[model samples]
Target: MKTTSSLSRILILVSALLMVSAYFTPLWQISLWAPQYPEGLNMKIWIDRLSGDVDIINGVNHYIGMKHIGQEMFPELQYLVYVFGAIIAFGVLAAILAKRWALYTYLLLLLILGLGVLVDMYLWGYDYGHNLDPSAAIKVPGMAYQPPLIGYKELLNFLAYSGPDTGGWILGASVLLAGLASFREFRAK
Candidate 1:
């Protein structure tokens, strides 16, 4: 009987633990700056909710015709916790099994899930920015307020910066650990 290396199993288990952090930390953040507010404003996105100056941000978004953001507005928030739980479960199972194939499959699924998250966020941003209400207080014929998917962008006078936050960093580290484990496994074969 062939057995997987101890290091691979340990790494997979560690990855599972790191994924749990996603539940409590904000996964992404957007910061806004304009001449009026030199201190800047921030919005945090989590799996199941939004935080950090959301009311202020929503007030600002109203002028640009973006829909008011609330937890009820995002259906994904209701289901994403389960998805993260499943990923964590899978990682734990792979670690316990200590099988080479199991580890590889788990890593691949995790990677695909991560990419899906990015795409979903982009789609949400696109809709929020492009789908403006016709009767908004302020109207600029062709202006859109789409926040950057993963970087900085200028949305009129506001400079917006979007990137991964605490949970995101943990997710990234989990992915990195899985990758390193895969690399080691492949080399051993």
Candidate 2:
């Protein structure tokens, strides 16, 4: 029983570390590294250079949108949903199982921050992806409308510092707290 308790604590601690480390390392960087933009523009660029089609207009924005997300300032990405979801799931479990107020506090903070991030991302998508109807384009011609996949960029960057360490620290800390809570729960059992 003691071993189980200790093991649960260890597991919870590990979970916390993973969730928290995610903030610093940002697992999404996995998506960022050699980001796959829409239609693989890097490859296209290479092919175009070879074929001398560089001047020929391409669906650059759409291609860019589909290929990678982080390069553009305020890039629209729906992927944030998954991140936020993970955060929430961890937070909720911690909240229900955790007896400590500090853990609850972390959960609250996650909720608040998570909601703000979600809203911002949704709006970014709404603004960036709004392609107009062809008929509307003829009459109310305006900025080219982007599809949803290419439009929603998550916007919860820490105001203090936008670097990996800054955001990662906060996110990591949150995960750590969550893991602690889970460990505590397991320990209780």
Candidate 3:
């Protein structure tokens, strides 16, 4: 009979709870630093909203003609919370089923979700960076201000860094925990 160890089930449940907690934390953050603004500007992206120095960031972006970084710009915000809720539910069901197949399916879903998020972020960055207005105040002959997806980049005089926030770290740990559970179940089989 196909089965999952009790420990594996516990791990899956724990991961699910951790993901739920991520709903209350910032999932991603983008920061910008320049000589004029020694303090740096930060924008934190939550599951359903944005926080931190958004207004300031928008004001700065205005000079370069980048689209305003606002909640209205991201339709995903309207339904992303529901998507995560469903993923968490899948995890809970996987734990309750206590079957190797269920755990593997949950792991697969997590992988897909992670990849999809990265692709989406990259696309958004591309559009924002490439779609500059002809009437912008600052225009480099062939420069695009696309920020790094997961690291540091220099754009003009500013240093931009993009990476996961507290919630992202928790979610990453949760994914790893789930992976461990999957590996254990695979070994048991």
Candidate 2 has what TM-score? Answer: 0.36
Across residues 93-161, which tens digit of lDDT does each residue of candidate 1 receive? 999999888889889988998999889889989999999999999999989888899999999899999
TM-scores for every candidate against the unseen true structure = 0.95, 0.36, 0.97
Off by over 4 Å in 3: none
- Per-residue lDDT for 83-188 in model 3, tens only? 8999899999999999888899998988898898889999999999889888999788889989899999998899999999999999998899999999988877
Model 1: CA > 4 A from native? none
Higher-scoring candidate on lDDT, 2 or 3:
3
* Sort by TM-score, top down from the best: 3, 1, 2
Candidate 3, which ten residues in sequence have the lowest lDDT sum? 15-24
lDDT value for model 1: 0.91
lDDT of candidate 2 vs native?
Answer: 0.38
Best by TM-score: 3
lDDT of 2 at 77: 31
Clashes of each: 0, 17, 0
lDDT score, residue 103, model 3? 90
